[model samples]
Target: MDLKPLLNKLENYHTEKPNRVFTMYLNTDPADPDQQGGEWRLQLKNGLNNFETYLQEDGDSDEKRNYWAVKEKVQHYINENERNLKKSVIIIATADEDIWFAETLQMPVKTEFFWEEQPQLRQLKELQKSFPKTGIILTQKDQVKYIDAELGTVKDTALYELDLDTEDWRQHQGPHRADSNLGSGGAKTSKKDELAERFEANRARWYKSIAPELDQIAKKHHWERIYLVGPSDEVNDLEQHMNKKVEGKINKNLLDHEETKVLNEVV
Candidate 1:
């Protein structure tokens, strides 16, 4: 979800023709008071129709054909994904389909559309600024999860679990949905007190051991802000060992929750 490259691509995107690019920014959040009545549908209808009207008045047949082609595909995409629509939907496309960038983001966006030479990017840049790339670290005792996110949507995830036998951290990268193995290394029958005592004695040393790996991940993701979520004692210990500064800390052991829920709680 890094926007710098995409922004650069769209910034310089233009054609010798009069107008062939289409950009759309729709605020589809039902929770937003302004959008409670499903007004975006009407706005989109009117906005698109207004563009067609303008073209009919002053645009040529070739331009009109191109515009209609792009509009048909855009409308189909929106209709198909309307049920999964989040707070905002942003799309920038061209007539020939050489460049198509679309995203459904959890963040809000101003409802706007453009039929111009280049993509409308001022609002997009500001949105990225408000919720830049971030890493939300959820740590309990021996496990830490990193959520690589931008503009309130997750891009990637990595789980770091301490291999007690090797006293080394292991990294697993993907959308690992299960959190059953957080506190223990698959030792579900082990007594809670036993596990607690074992980690309590070596918590600081173990966390310190994995701190450098976390720093490496931070650099790899170019995280703008890091939020540590766990008990204050565990979070504080890990924060001390990390070279990068933590932007926020939440005192709650949320390792077993769903990632999106965990992200919502932490970030």
Candidate 2:
């Protein structure tokens, strides 16, 4: 598809609110219900009037309409306050598999990381060493505490908050629990329950893990807003919990794209 029109729309959208950072999340997973998996694109706009027209003409569905609405709101906000758009930044997060597709399409690729088998602390340390400039750790809610400790000393290390519905956790838990029951049901259940209990017991650890990084981001960038986007149920739940803890410091939004699709959109 020709992305010029979309790009032009985004350009106009951005022009309107030059001060607010503009972040876009695209679902790249082939299995994502919302995404028609393909090459990703970024469209910068100073406003959304033209983009809204294009979306209407493109015949996006009701769900797509919601996406467009959010996009338009951001666009409109930018348009109304063009003077404030200078410090704005655009960030896109997606799956590792779609990174190639995004690169192949020549789309702008920001930071890229995937869920791995090792503990989040190890992963964070490795990532910090590699991308030393990175100040924010985007991860599943369950790993926040681990990530916090891993990069606590690093300057400007903050956790981006993402929300996943509780229902999604319930849906995934059946199979997760089933797998837990396999071979060593009792032992697995006990271990899993123990982990959950630990998460609950030391919830402050999770917040403290990224608190320093968040402060740095705010201080250095004068960043007043944060956008979290991800698939992990633990991450989503933790985001909600942290929002309460951090109070005015964090801004949380739940990305509605399916797990798979999230990669496509962000990557």
Candidate whose TM-score is highest? 1
Global lDDT of model 1: 0.83
User: How does residue 59 of candidate 1 score in lDDT?
Assistant: 56
Question: Any idea what lDDT model 2 has?
Answer: 0.32
TM-score of each model, paired residue for residue: 0.87, 0.24
lDDT of 1 by residue, 145-204 (tens): 888888888898778877766878888656653542334445565565576777889889
Q: Estimate, for each residue in 1-267, the C-alpha lDDT of model 2 and write its tens digit.
A: 122332344334321121122233222333333334232222243233444565467674652454354554544543564443221223221122111111111122222222112111232234334322212223333432111111112222222331222211111211122122112224456656775565556544554555554455434543223334433443444456443222122222223223323323322
TM-score of 1: 0.87
